[model samples]
Target chain A: MRYKVRELTDMQNSALKEIINIGVGNAATSLSKMIKHQISIDIPELRVEIIEKVPEAAGGADKVVSGVIMHVDGDINGYIMMLLSEDSAATICKAINEEEDTDIHTPMNQSMLEEIGHILAGSYISSLAEFLTLDVKISPPMQTFDMLGAIMDQILIEMSQNVECTLFFDTVFVLEGKQMEGILLTLFDPMGMDKLLGRIDEMT
Target chain B: MIIVGMADSAVAKKPEKLTTLGLGSCIGISLYDNRNCIGGMVHIMLPSVENARAKDNRAKFADTGIPDLVDSMVKQGAAKHHLTAKIAGGARMFSFSSNSNLNIGERNLAATKEVLDKLRIKTIADDTGDTYGRTIILDTETGQLTVKSAQKGEKRY
Candidate 1:
């Protein structure tokens, strides 16, 4: 049976949330180790949203951001993105490389930022696969720095061809007692999402 | 000024401006009739909708969107024969393995041209197929299109 995204039951939402909670937890741990500072991640928001509204979920359509894109394939197929505000990205970059003149737009900074995205986004998908007991492989991370709307436009266009809605997972990262917002978006194929919900139903 | 959202299109007459924000791999096609000072913009996400699993959103695909946009422009006093086109924002935001799906930027640009050709609309200028995202604006009075990007500041096409 096909499951309409809007018709998702509370139980199903909770189950999916639990799986993501685990994944986000794992990602936070890895981020902390990489930055050598205690990092706290709080994800109080997650939902399946229409493609047009997915960009708004991160903020406004025109907000500039730095992000990494990962493709999940194999038994399950979907896309995962880690979006950070310019300030947050710069902070993370500075923590990794303390060169006074290095900036986020520099080649050195770009590579470091991509590595940060790979480690965080990689752990996110791997943990979800473990919880679902599904064999999923993550593609190499693709890093981008541009308008928030532009980055999401690419993903939303891809998602719209496959599904009417996209799964949004958002969180906040606290570093050095400063709060920074993080958006982890997952856009699963329609059939894949239906299958995933079914698997979650069975496990529940 | 009117704002066009993703998978959407809009038309305007003289002195009015139409804009679309955040065009990454998606293509933004601007149609204008210099004789009538009428312009239209469509932000199409995919090349075609033949195998699309979702319900048909005409404005979301190049195949269906270009015709619909032209039809609307004609209804607003524009002559189809005089319509010229400018397109922007089919960008590959990432470099991945040779997956055609990830190469959506190129596909969208190609599809836009094919549709414009079928309609016989002359494409005067285009800024597309790069590794950056763009926001575009269309001025009906001047029939000029301005494309802006984070990497490349701004250019009028």
Candidate 2:
């Protein structure tokens, strides 16, 4: 029988959160090193929720932001995403380029954001793989600036087709002293989630 | 303003506006009847629900959602013949070399128009297909739709 996301036990739930925290923490480390700014991450949240509620749950659907998305392949299948507020995107851009301007729309700046996202995602997914002992690889990142819902609605649509519930794992992080924040989000399909839970079971 | 959410639909009459936010690849179809000043909006994720496992959510697909919205508008006193449609938000937000999921937006946009055509609803305005996101609001009184984006500014049609 397929294990539903909501069927996760309390122990499983906390374990899931811990796994996500490790992934986000790894990303935070990579980001802090690249930007040379202190990164502070909040406790990661892992929830199994209906697809329609995801946009509202993450943030308002219309909130404008910068987004970086990548598809995960190999042993696990899912999408890894980053959503940055305008302030966070600009602040990160400014730090990386050592420029006074804080714009992320410039071609060079956009690419920088993509690379940063790639590095962060690489670090994040590897930790997940290592902990679960699963082989995984990620596609090149696609970066865009748009409304939060617009940036991720397609992924939700694709996920919604197969299952009524989705795993929404997110962590909010800030660039210290700048007070600029961003969100790291990962969506694993139900089958992939089942595999993760199976691995977690083996460890226990 | 009433906000229609993904796989959700809403209907209203004069003085009440209908809006849908954060349309990346999903299509937002707005229907209006100027005679009665009735407006409706549906945020559809897929072109059809025929293949879906869950058939209960009619508002989640273009084939079922648009007709359902129209029927509800008629039930709310909007004349069917006078109904005109305005649509926005079918953006290819991200692209990958081999990923078909990213192309859902284009497919959604096409299916929406096809449904409207079959229903004989005149499509008065269309703002779709790009690499950005859009938020749209439909004014029931004027049947005007305002499309807003992060960097694209705003436009009404």
Candidate 3:
């Protein structure tokens, strides 16, 4: 059945938010420990947007950003993405390598960013699976620096063929109290959304 | 400047710059008539609308969108035969993309070319098939197409 975003009850929405909040909080904690620095996150904001609007909703289409994306498979199918500004990527690299002139474009730096994304996603997905009682695994990470809209358009296109709405959420993070900030986004297909809502219903 | 979003299209005359931003695995086709100084741009995600369940947005597919753009420009006083096409922004984005995500950029570009060929529209320029994203802008006054990328330097055709 095609699930419309407006049809979701407030109870389901809040429950989904609470689950996402816990998952993001756990991921944030993992990153903070890895960097050995404090990490603060904005409230996790969720949305159900048409596939085409996803790029604009995440940020401006043309805005350049560093992105690491991975597909989530198994019981649920979707994508998990990490988007960081150039400065944010630099800072994250600096925190780990503790070196000067952290060029985020270098192959080494790129993989480093991918690893960071993987670890955070691992933590987040684990918590989500544990909470929702669902089985999901993330694919290998793909990292690139490009316009935010371009980076995500391909994924959105892949999603659009089967689903009308993309269920996604964004959580902004600031690391070590610096201006370094990044966003973590999760996008799910309609079937996945239905499965998630079904699991939510069963748990309740 | 009129910004065309993904699965969107726009038609404008001279003095109005038409642009579509951040395209990946999608084709941004710009049609222009130098004599009339009129331009049209479409950001198409899919190659054809034939197989899509939702056909309301003709701008979302290359086959439907390019014709719609041409018709719009022609209606606004531009001659259909005088229209020339410049295209950009069909990139793999991720080199390792596999399975259902395979070479969609190339597919979109190929579909666009097929449609343009059928429409007898000459494609003067194309910057595509790389593993990067591009934003394209069309100058209605001069019919100049500029393709920009974050990693690659800018190019105009």
Candidate 4:
């Protein structure tokens, strides 16, 4: 049976929220160290739904570009994606890399995506592993810079099934006193849900 | 001198050559023959082996794209034994956590080397690794390879 947001028990809801909170905290710490600047991280607003429901949840964002995707397999199969606007990405890179100029050229743009991909995947997966006490392997992160349509097309083509669940969140990064926005999307299969719930149940 | 832009691939015959400008972590594999002067260039994006959605875009993956380039070169009278290979690109553009799984650039270089070795084609030269991008050019007429790196300038690799 497909699981919806409402189907989640109270315990499950709190567990998921805690997992995201920890992940965002780790990400903020890493960003602070890398950029050598004081940064603030906000708990991502979380929504759980089937993959097909992503568009409706995405809301009125005119475009979705500069994304990184990491696929996980073993016990469960799913994907973790971080999406950002090109402008926001440039600003973040300038802040982190200490670049005087925040121009987003092809080469610099690619490098920024690589760095962000590493941090987001690292923190998210580590938090999940710690919460579940299960070691999960992540594939190399792939960065895709394209329009919303192209991004959605690629996701649909790769996933091939609309039955999967998606966890979406928006992370606001305050770096050097400048606020930058980033979005994280985590996909989980039915099997993944079972594994996640099982682990949470053990915690209680 | 033929230039292959980003997301572009090209082939050359005797007296002609192909090149790709500015390769950052992206790999450039040159297939050439000293005798027939038939060659091609592929600037691949990722190092994916699985036939995923990118399989449709042959230029995106090394596993599928490299073979396709080889087959096309052979059809143009470039024999396996007579062919020489040269590769460049694959740089660590940024610093990240150690736990991040596959290194796409490293994987691209490794997959390219392995595929060429299996085909019994010796890699005449290569300039890979480091944290900078490169501009690569191949001369089908003379089998000369030139690599221009971002920080180090241009040189023959």
Candidate 5:
């Protein structure tokens, strides 16, 4: 049965939020370890919105962001995006590549960002998998620097074919001393909502 | 100037531009009439609207959006015979998906081209089917379409 995103009950919303909160915590911990600094993440926000409103979650439709895109499959399939402002990306890259490693060049910045993205995503998805008892596999990260709306258009086009609305888990993170902020977004497959809800119920 | 959102379409006249941002796998189809200096752009999400559980959004699918865009341009003083088209976007962002159903970028572009042909709109230029995303702007004044991307910089057609 097809489920309307807007119809999610308060209890369902709370459950999903809690689940995502755990995932975000794990991601933050992994990031902190990699950067060798304290990282703090804001309370994750969960919402069900039309595709157009998604860009607003990251800032605006025209907001330029450094994005790392990946697809999650196996039990519950969907798209996961790690979006960072150009400044935040630069900050993270600088922190990670602090040593005067001559090997790191201009184009290597992108590779460094992708590596960080992969580490964070791996932690987040693995947390979700362990918590939900679902085996989820993630595709390799594809990096892009562009307007958030355009990056989203890639995933939302395929989604719009089946579901009119999408569910997103949005989290903001700040590197404690640096105060650099980034947003991590998870656009859950609308078709997988039923399966996800069922799994949630099983947990409770 | 008019800004088309996801699954939306807009029309404009001379000196006005139509813009849409972040066109990953979605197709941004623009129809311009040089004679009248009128233009219309549609951000179509799906290949076809037929069998869609939700038929209310005509601009959300190629089959319906292309015809509707043509009709709107004709109504707004654009000469049907003078209309030409340019399109951009339709990128396959995820490379690891083995599922053919995930090849929506190629499907969307093919379906858009087919619909444009059926409507007799001559496709003048297009930048589609790549791993990168694009933001497109259509100039009604000159019928010049600008495609901007972070990886490839910008191009005008």
Candidate 6:
């Protein structure tokens, strides 16, 4: 038995890239407002691939700590996974809360994950909705603190054989003259791709 | 004193030993034996036996962790049928887009309940849902279990 490799067309890829660009821009705006600092986000590097290939493709990070997961449904039905180091997550949270104390042991426990999940997931979903002019509802964020392998294993279990595209962004969150780096993964269904491209075509 | 961490279990035989911690969407199981002055606890992160090979692995799934906890307790004189069970954790941590046949926390909670029922062990207390975290502690010497939640005060059983 053989399985055909599913690939996204160039037009589809470009359209999706534009959508993500808007999404990240919205996320940066939210960050800037929350931290009362100028938060800039770099253009993300996007790739479409099967779910099985995500681990190897994203295997270059030295350490992975906290993970934020959100599922978007409405013209698309796929989950988004964002990975960040503990230090980076602390920084992001500090930026959001505008805390002067940089102590990492601020009892983040689970609230940190929950709040970040809400902000980032909200930004991505809302931006996508506005750009495409569609109504979408985002569920509450769920976070997991584990190694990269464990995080990938959980994603694989939930996703089975479906092909999931991962968007890797080299996020440089600057606040108070400090910088933190993080990665974001946005997974979407093929139906989402069609709707997104359809909306883009209507605009241009 | 109460201690809750990953891959470790405690038994409280004395009433003074009050311990309970939150499980979140993770699965937590408790074991208590009155006569033998023994107790144990196990909290598993995932629901399946497949991810057992990973580094820094716990007792794997509920199926594996349940028996492992039971056997260890029995070796210390905890009778199989006499042991009482109290379980919690297994909340739907996130909503996935696929809607695939994978409800991990629910599956884990179900699997644990099934094992206890098959063994004829009575579950005296339980609090499992898609809510926040849970804290569980067992007194090894007193055979008492205490459950604590972020939203609610501590309860003893």
Among all candidates shown, the one with the greatest DockQ: 2
Worst 10 residues of 1 chain A by lDDT: A94-103
Where model 6 places Cα greater than 4 Å from the true spot, the runs are A1-9, A59-62, A94-109, A164-170, A202-204, B1-100, B104-157
Better of 3 and 4 by DockQ: 3
Docking quality band of candidate 4, CAPRI definitions = incorrect
Q: Note the Cα lDDT for every prediction shown.
A: 0.83, 0.87, 0.87, 0.67, 0.81, 0.62
Cα error, candidate 4, residue A71 (Å):
1.2
A199, model 3: CA deviation in Å?
0.9
Roughly what TM-score does model 5 have, to 2 decimal places?
0.90
* Interface RMSD after interface superposition, each candidate: 1.4, 0.9, 1.2, 11.0, 2.1, 9.3
**Each prediction's DockQ against the real complex:** 0.67, 0.85, 0.79, 0.02, 0.55, 0.05
- Please rank every candidate by lDDT, starting with the best: 2, 3, 1, 5, 4, 6
Off by over 4 Å in 1: A98-102
TM-score (0 to 1) of chain B for each candidate: 0.96, 0.97, 0.96, 0.90, 0.96, 0.80
Q: What is the C-alpha RMSD, rounded to one decimal, of candidate 1?
A: 1.9
- Candidate 3 lDDT over A9-59, as tens digits, reads 887888898888888889889988887888877677778888888888888
- TM-score of the candidate numbered 4? 0.53
Instruction: Report, for candidate 6, the interface RMSD.
Output: 9.3
Q: What is the C-alpha RMSD of each candidate to the true structure, in Å?
A: 1.9, 1.5, 1.4, 10.5, 2.6, 9.5
lDDT by residue (tens digit), candidate 3, B1-157 = 9999989999999899999999888989999999999999999999888888777889999989999999988999999999999999888987544447678899999999999999999999989888888999999989999999998989999
lDDT of 5 by residue, A68-87 (tens): 88888888778788888887
Model 5 stretches with alpha carbons more than 4 Å out: A99-107, A202-204
lDDT of 6 by residue, A1-204 (tens): 021224455666677678888898888788667556676667877755544345445542113457677766666666666777678777766666677655543456456656666687789788888878887766566676544433544454344333333443344455556766666676655455556667766776
Over the full model, what C-alpha lDDT does candidate 1 score relative to the true structure?
Answer: 0.83
